[model samples]
Target: MAKAPGFVSLKEILTTFKISRRTAFNWLKTINQQLQAQKLDQVVNIPRYGYKLTDRTKKSLTQKIAKVSSPQMGHETILNAHERQTEIILLLLDQEHYLSINQLAKMFHCSRNTIIKDFKALKRHFPALKIGSSRLGHRIISDENSIRLTVYELLLRQDKLVYAFINRLNYSFSQAKELVIKAQQQLHMSFSENSLQQLTYLLLFTKWRITHNQTIDRSENWQWIAQNTKDVLPTCTKLLGKLGGNKELKGEIVFLSKIFLCSQATEVDCINKNLYHDINNIAQEIIFRYEQLTEQQISYRVFTKTLCNHLYATFFRVKFGIPFSSSEVDEIKWQYPVLIKFTAIACAPLEHYLQKKLPSEEVALICLYFGSVNNREYREFTESDKLKRALLAEVLVVCSSGIGTSAMLYHELSKTYPLIKFSLPLEIRDLAKIFQHNYQAKLIISTTILPKGKYPIPAVKVKAVLTKHDQTIIDSFLRQEVPRKLEHNASAVNSLVSIINEYADVKDEKGLRLSLDKFIFPGLQKNNKADLPTLSNLLPAKHIKVLRKKDQLKWQTVLKWGCNLLEQDEIIDQFYFEKIVQLINRYGPYMLIANNIFLAHAAPSNSNKKVGLSLILLDQPLEICSRGESAWVTCMFVLSPGKEKEHEKALEQLVDIVRNQENINRLLKAKSPQEVRQFLLSFY
Candidate 1:
């Protein structure tokens, strides 16, 4: 009948069509689109009802369906190449026996060559399919579980086929579905609509396999997955009972359960023992590495919950060698080059712990997991964090290079805004190590480019030394975006209250809590490093020696002269000098890090006693020969790192001073060792 216009709920539509919720919605959308194309009135979905078809639309569609049925359904239905390829794969998955190319060609009403082309396309797209043929027929050559995973992938990519796929079940579809629904709801286990449909169909296929005597061997293979599903076992058992499955069929059920486990979650809280104990730690380590690598902060919630959810499935997929539902690693690698590299580095923890490289597809999926986090807005604090910063705002100050740049920023910022709290100078590498708990800092003021990623707090970019314009920008940020210095005013209020109490007594017993809250907040918010080796500490007048324009020295003598100063100063052992000499001898001009200057050094060792730098400047450059090549050295400096990254700031400063022509000229033209040291000390 062409039914009369009326409101109908989505539930009634699902019941009427015997399709999953996702399929029913998709069908409705397709129907509406077709109606719109024909310039006819379409069905309208009502909120409480499913859809309303007025008399005219109902009558129009009835005529349209009749006209389409005669040609499309009554005769051979032609399919596009992509559509036919999908149906062929579906047939291979459904068949218990191998299907011949001739049989598939006849069923789809296509030639053998066309069918073969489709097969070639399938192999080209999915190498994991392992398409094969024998004299008997062609078939999927992999295990049954793998075939099922491919079906899910197909359904995900081509969702319009979902309705037909779920509709063609051979077993007790309605009753088993009822039981599955009851158990899922009763056990508080829920899944995304798409995943629920896929897993339900997977359960049907598993049951079908068992009925055909293709049951999985060694059920203990699934016992490890049992730990996360103990509470859901009773529900699974009831469904297994409905399928006439005994204890032996338990492995298939557990495997089916994993489909829902790995899929996107909706309302169900995904935290579990493995999550709380194992995965969260992995997520934290991943976050640490991302921070260290990106020099930025991310949403902790995104990392701990969203990313934790992803890692849970990823670990199992890689361990079991299942690469279904992965983005193409190559495609993602090209699209997200920087992100992929950072993800690869961030996942080093997992790779080390797993004692193997992550599969390329898994790496891409994990890249996607990190890719989701790149755009998520940083954490926004409530009044509680603002209250913590109300007293003295914690600001992170960082600079581009040298130990003094950040220090210079801190002194200027603190002097200008004395009421605000500030951290010691920070390097670009140190930004991640700060604000492990983000609420501790309210603002970031940097002399360098702070990472452009999701840094939780507001960051202000300025010069190493503050300008009036920079001060104005900081003033605007503190006023507009940050907490005010309101906590300091609380003490003034207490003093005024005390003076008022000295004059008179007041009574407002019922409003005392509110009264005190006006003066005080309920609670205060509760929230490393070796010193940088500076130039003044590392280089002294005694360590700095120079040569005049008339007194040019050989490059070999230049390296030896500077290195012996370090040895006599007790900065390095004799072998340290030999190591430098050996480096220059073995690798000619290897010590020349800059144009016309040489930085002589050996790897840090136990022999190096202190972190220091010794310099020798020459007015006239000397040329040296080794390995039949020649290079010039106007200045020679020897540095013993003593420890790695400990003297980076001093090294940066030294590079800065040598890079400038005027500074080098002043040192080269120096009258004494005292003058050369004084010129270098000015930079500190």
Candidate 2:
């Protein structure tokens, strides 16, 4: 109280004077009364905080605050920019109220302009270091957790004054080191040299925060804070209690337990029984999303199980904060930038579920898990799988019957020909629109005879009324119209070879010819580079639109706009758009795959001639309400997986492009469609 009259915690006051709370409060009351009688500013009590002294009050009480604040290096050592910025951060953490520019300049032996520059430069690294004029002068309001993490980081780099910071406040610096080392040895065979020191400092720093009335919000992550720390909670409880902590409060202990979760050795196989199940569920989803994005299935045994345990361990480490150093991270980032980006997208739901952002090292670590297993090691499709692909065969169910009958017929035929895509029954007059748009449809089963010159697509006349003869006719028509070959001419393959030769020197013309024939020829190799559609192939400049808030578009409106782009290219029929709407209405906004990015699609429709992908970037978000969930959508991607799931490659590329908020911002800020297209081209 005599040397430094900044805000000090009640615990520190009581501990220093060896007094109870009541005694401390009574002393504060008396001190305030005496100061008020003298017409001087008294110590102010801030709820959730202990006490702070105003400069006028300190000046009035000439006996108090005898010494001015000094730097860690005293008057001898002048700090460089980086060192001074870090020192400034440390100094702010000491003051309860604002420290003026003049005071700071005096303490650091610098000019006001130098301090201002330091403020600006420090903010570049520590964005949370808020600098603003308040009651009297410019003071920083830095987050406690962030500042402590900064301290931990400083300690990591062997900052000498880090310990002085803890000691200056007369805070407890317990030997939690011996305890942590003992517990870690019980679980791990060998540990890193500084692991004990890091864990010890983390626990003590947390205890220091608790003592100073700066505690973690217990109610924030109550679910994880409650159940996920059972194994380590008791140990942490004993350790904290031994170091003069409030034994009744378990919040600090719970936080320490989470730290313990992230500290296991690489060779350890310990599965945190409580956290593993949740982590496993997240792992399953990431794998599924990864498969969908890449359009290739990953086996569950090695990849799935490994990712689950790895994520379980890494989750807490990332959440709590760990700086990882890996040379491979840089190389992997440079070499497979797209893969890392896609992996992050796939891991997005996990991050959302946990409500925490993962660091790049964690993301890169997951990429290594994907890289180990993702060399086109796709699951071999069985005969049944091939049949399922053929099942995209569409049939136009034409009926002159009313709406009620059409509804009944649609479901009945759907169940009857489970493999076929039976379009909802349309009136005979509706046949023209269907024929014009859905020319890829193989057959039209009509309740009444169509006009002779009405359409080029073949039709079968079936009775509107139920009959055994009608079923036979429908059965005979679909069996013959089972999905036909891809139908590529010799010239198509020759042109492809010539294009490849033109751009790249063909070292193996004969080998390249064989590969091209297989890629082009039906059923030979659907996954070939030539066959798998990508964003570059599907979404041209014409297909992308920059929408705005002024348009006042709804979810369905932008959905239609995306569909219209594909429809213009004849990649999909109008019915495909209708199908997406119907399915979304029936199910939910499953189309909103990630935050603000809507991947609008439905099951493949064989009637669509080619795979289509289109984008609509809204300057403002559109709220999508459905039968289930509701979400705001920023970007809507319309994908028509025509006849096959070939659009997956395109979807994968789109995920890579927009998964990051930064990239989305960059794309949205583009002035023209050509700029947007060129931006996309850069990724490929």
What C-alpha root-mean-square deviation, in Å, does candidate 1 show against the real structure?
A: 20.6
Clashes of 1: 4
How close is every model to the real structure, measured as TM-score?
0.43, 0.45
Which residue pairs in candidate 2 have backbone atoms (N, alpha carbon, C) closer than 3 angstroms, thus clashing?
none
The segments of candidate 1 whose C-alpha lies over 4 angstroms from its true place after superposition are 1-82, 95-98, 106-111, 121-132, 140-142, 156-159, 170-190, 211-213, 218-220, 227-229, 232-235, 266-275, 326-334, 374-684
lDDT of each: 0.61, 0.64
User: Cα RMSDs of all predictions?
Assistant: 20.6, 28.5
Q: Scored by Cα lDDT, where does model 2 land? A: 0.64
Evaluated against the true structure, the overall lDDT of model 1 is 0.61
> Which 10 residues in a row give candidate 1 its minimum summed lDDT?
65-74
